[model samples]
Target: MAGSGETSEARALGEALAALRRDCGLSQAEAGARIGMTGQGWGLYEAGKRSSLFRPDVQRRLTGALGATPEALMLQAPGGAAVSTDRPKTSHPDNAPAHGLSARGRAFEGAASDVRRLRLETDELAPWASAGTVLEYALGRWPRRGQGCVIQLQDGLRKVRLYDRADEAEMVVLGAGALDRSERIARSDVQSVSAVISRLDDA
Candidate 1:
């Protein structure tokens, strides 16, 4: 009976974690990548098979990766009510000048932490960005349509593309060069889609 009870509680906690991750618009792979874990490892937590899920530190790490708090996790658990599902407001209008940097870009300028940088070694993104251009991206921030983004695939391939749109099952993007055709990629194969907050060209 005690074993069954523990299993039930773990499952409930896992469900709550899954709920929070969905609320943040993250896939299992994306959430796991944020914490340097594999999607399968993260799934173990959601399947209630990982004992570490019961630790406060583990709870914080999991929730933090989803941009949530431990309190939110508990509120999302079974029999708990009052979980807020509000999302953050966009800092600028969608019609903002294309030449202007985004609010996130301004904030990331010269700030070394919490941002990942990628240097283009090919002209695949020409016109928008050429070889030798450097990109700084934020992990959790989703890009607006037409904005630049870096898509990380589950198979360890990363592509720089123009964000088009995404639904529950797939995402469409505009590739560069002769491959400039609009392409649809399966969401399940994607690990993360990070917004390219800033781009710098080599002098």
Candidate 2:
């Protein structure tokens, strides 16, 4: 349940993100591609339509993709005061399941704070996310249609795919390519899903 105050705040933040991206001279599709999202999906964030855009992890990654910090995306308050970008620290137990991983099964280092990094080890995500590309994803943020995602299975495995849709019994995902073949998986097999927030081409 969201309160009125929160909604207003999200709207302000969204506007800030939009302005910043425009300042960088990137169109919605171009900016979204840098962050593994579709033009429409990124537009939603800028339109202040998705409440999840307020999440600290999401904020960090989105702004980071634009070469800015989270603080830079904060909206001004009443009387022109600046909103704080501070966020509470997230805690996880030592034995808790990690948020994500690389395709090679190696643990992603330094992603414990906000976003996880996964290196593409195969050509399955080619062109869009080719081998050697490192992807940044935000935990707890669900990707919109046509957006790429990192899905965690019950067995602790992760897969990167373009999100399609889901129902009570299953989730649909599409492979990255011109064909964009879709696959269906039982809902029971999925443990969680995260939105891929950025793509870094590895040299």
Q: For each candidate, give its TM-score against the true structure.
A: 0.48, 0.46
Badly placed stretches (over 4 Å) of model 1 are: 1-112, 176-180
Q: lDDT of each model, Cα atoms only? A: 0.69, 0.67
Candidate 2 stretches with Cα past 4 Å from truth are: 1-112, 176-179
Tens-digit lDDT track of model 2 for 23-104: 7788988777654668898899987788777666567556645655454565322323254333543333334553322111
| Model 1, TM vs. native | 0.48
Cα miss at 96, model 1 (Å)?
35
Query: Can you write out model 1's per-residue Cα lDDT over 132-165, one digit (the tens) per residue?
Result: 9999987534566677888888788888898876
Error of 2 at 166 (Å): 0.9
